[model samples]
Target: MSLRVEGLCVARGEAVVVRGVSFSVPLGEVTVLLGPNGAGKTSLLEALSGILPIQAGRLELCGREMSRASRVVRARAGLSHVQQGRVVFPTLSVEENLRVGARDGLEEAFRLFPELEKRRHTPAGQLSGGEQQMVVLARAILSRPQVLLVDEMSLGLAPLVVKRLLPVLKGLAEGGVGVLLVEQFARLALSLGHQALVMNQGRLVYSGPASALLRQPELLQWAYLGRSA
Candidate 1:
């Protein structure tokens, strides 16, 4: 499934949030959205997921246009999003939450993150932050989406936990799913993604091979290491 965003623009009321953002996530690989806070990364993800309206431009899933698709239409078309904040049903059991990811159950995500299996009966709110986030992702994966838009998977988690998550994401890309990961840490995004796009004030500033960004110390400094933008 090829996911294409051509001149995609999103707005909040009359104020534009994501302006003319164009990029393509070819099937079977990971593409990272690198940006600072308030860069419209989450808004773009919302647009792609059909949760927010697009003020202008287009989104294509496979060959179909999605700029005006309903939320259910988007979900059934194989687009899944794990938004920031890991909003799970606090009262729901872990297994119940996993069930929300897919009807067939938690086997696949449990296979990917075995830790979930052991605590399947616990309440979602009882799990640690990383565990809860994994449960959220597990549910999204169960939807069997071809395109996955993940926002801040590393937010407020230990580096080691994030380190573990990236490999599972890699396996997803290797298996022919398109991943659009919105990341706070450009270093991690560049290291994990096949390609990277930098977003600032809702516009894409730079885009190219992850390795290319990785090689330029000055660019990394501007992005994650924190010198200039």
Candidate 2:
């Protein structure tokens, strides 16, 4: 199954943020969305998660149309979003946070990130940045989503911590979950992605194999800078 978007448009109030975007995130593959600031990557991810309404166009998951589904409906339909920043309840214990995601799957989540089991009773705010990110990830994993949208997951984190976290996403993709990732670190995202798409000012400028983009930095530079390669 795959998550498909066609002519997708999103707006914030009166201003359009994403314009006529079309792409597909297939099962067992990582599709990386790359662009510089104000490139509309986050807006597109938010639309896919159903947090932002689609001003136009269509969305389909597993071949079923979900263009107008609510955020909660999308979540129940196997969609999980790990937004920018390590979002967790600071006052709640780690277990409590996971419980919020789902009452079960604690063991599986802990198995994926064993460090969490040791800190299960600790308040999430007390954990290190990386550890807190793990909690967010573990919570998403516990939900057992078929399609995962991760927006700027590595922001404000150390390189080592990012290294540990990204592989978990890759592993999830390998195990038949479609992962749509928007990462600030383009090189690292390209390395893990199977397909890549670049955006510029709310439109897709490039779409191709991740390896192809790696071999051609100028294309990426052009898309981000509006310069001739």
Give each model's whole-structure lDDT: 0.85, 0.91
Show where candidate 2 strays beyond 4 Å: 227-229
The alpha-carbon lDDT assigned to residue 24 of candidate 2 equals: 94
lDDT of 2 by residue, 34-147 (tens): 988998999999999988999999999998889999999889999899999899999999999999999998998899899999999999999998898899998998898899
Clashing pairs in 2: none
Model 1 has an lDDT value of 0.85
Could you tell me how far off, in angstroms, the CA of residue 5 lies in candidate 1 after the best superposition? 0.8
Query: For residues 96-151, what per-residue lDDT tens digits would candidate 1 score against the true structure?
Result: 98787677856777898799899988999999999998898888888898999999
- Which runs of model 1 end up more than 4 angstroms from their true locations? 220-229
